[model samples]
Target: MDRLIQILKDPLLIAALAILVLLGAGELLSPGFARGDQIVRLLTVAAILGIVAAGQNLVVLGGREGIDLSVGAVISLGAVIAGNVMSGNDAAILPAVAAAAGAGFLVGIVNGLGVTVVRIPPLVMTLGMMGVLQGALVVLSRGVPSGNAAPALMAFVNQPFVLGIPGILFVWAAIAVLMAFVLRRTAFGWSIYAIGSNERAAVLTGLAAGRIRTILYGLSGLFAGVTGVCVIGYTGNSFISVGDQYVLPSVIAVVIGGTSLAGGSGSYTGTILGAIALVLLQSVLTTLQMEFWSRQVIFGATLLVLMLLYGRQARLRV
Candidate 1:
């Protein structure tokens, strides 16, 4: 108890543990919890959100008051575009995949430029980007998002191998491992953390804060693109605002995972854990036959209490 309290007294650590305990406890009580399938489902949800969280994770790590408001937009755009690549045939899938990824990269770069060169506030810039991307899609898509989903990609995303490990799960896991290493082991990683903690100090210490921030944004964009591609495979078609809802949840996932909202202080592991907590809540609520709106209301309230508790780290905005 003493050790636990000492840990939670640190706001960031508390957020991470709270999510894990709540969700982990729920998993213990779930019906037929011994079933391997149930375990798979839990991990699957965590993997899906972890991919999205990974995309946002980079944005958070970029520092310089950074946050990617356009993530939802990028995901939606990729989904809609990938659908067009399907042609209801398998051989044409590669082109579609390429197109979707390319589009994601372009959008991410735009976001990067808006932050680095344009000098717009990350929030305001991404907010505008959110609108712009949505508008462009609306103009091009004409209120209906239609596209063919590539079957090969879908298989890659959903197919299980080596004792039922879904490829997507592997992909997400690999990315997390790679990112954690980069953040902790490499000089670039050190620069990212240093810049986030104190951009000015980083500058004095001879870091290219602008370039690093730009690359971070670009990397974040690329990750989002990859996520969008997977989303297309998972959904099998593109629909309007399919990725729209993920924006806030992605942010919450990272913050709730114990990543400092103030930047330069967090773990990708926490984000992964946090994503599982969210999926667990959704699953438990559904199994118990709870109303969706009620869940939303309760979720909102709970988030409020949590924010009040651990959000002191956000005071770094000044």
Candidate 2:
């Protein structure tokens, strides 16, 4: 019993448990909840959140007050740009895709530069970038996003089929697995923890703290671009604030999964679990016919509760 309580105290374990509980309850409450198609649809949504969670995990795990506030803006801008660049040509889609990705990278670099070179706090740097990027989008799109993405690109993302499993589910799962490997198995992975644990100490010990911070932001940008692309595939078009909705959800998912906001600790598995739990929570609430505002209220309450629990842990020394 004591051991179980201790395990529950661990963020990753708690997140996983939340996933199981929510998922099981969802299955019990909904008709055909376990059906492959329904499960796939739920996973499709979860994947979108998970992809963004992966990037947020990097910023959070990188420490030194690192966080990516511009992720939503970056994604929105990327999708809008991709929409314009594709302009109904399947072949042309790749170039615009590259441009969209490049746009995200640039934003991330700006974030890193602001934090490291300009000495702005991460929050302020990203908040400023978010507004700047949104303004840039309006300018680039000429007040309206007129272009359409290629048909093939849209079909690929929306259609779900890969060895009898939904393509989107498998795609996101594959991404999560690959990321898990990278973080757990690679040398650069070590630098994430080292830098987060003690930026000055890491710098003294030979890790390029600034360079790595910059690169992590770049990685965050790169991931944001991928998410934007996937979303375009899912929605077949772009709106200015479409990608912005993901910002809070992404951060919340990563944090709920047990990745410390203070950094130097976390796992992709936890993030994945957290994403799943969030999706299941939404699914169950929708099934229950909860009002939109009420759902938001409940979400706020849940977050408050989690914060209280987490705060207690943060204040403890064990």
- Which 10 consecutive residues of model 1 have the lowest summed lDDT? 309-318
The digit string of per-residue lDDT tens for model 1 on 167-239 reads 7888887988898899899999898888878888888999988888877766666666666777877767777
Q: Candidate 1 regions off by >4 Å? A: 1-4, 9-30, 92-94, 311-314
10 residues in a row with least lDDT, candidate 2: 309-318
**Reference-based TM-score of each model:** 0.88, 0.91
Which ranges in model 2 have alpha carbons more than 4 Å from their true place? Answer: 311-318
Error of 1 at 304 (Å): 3.5
Q: How does candidate 2 fare on TM-score?
A: 0.91
Writing each residue's lDDT as its tens digit, candidate 2 over 187-274 gives 8988888887777788889988888888888878878987887778778888777788788778778778877777887888888888
Local distance difference test, candidate 2: 0.80
Considering only N, C-alpha and C atoms within 3 Å, which residue pairs clash in candidate 1? 83-147, 83-148, 84-147
Clash pairs, candidate 2, are: none
Q: State the lDDT at 109 in candidate 1.
A: 78
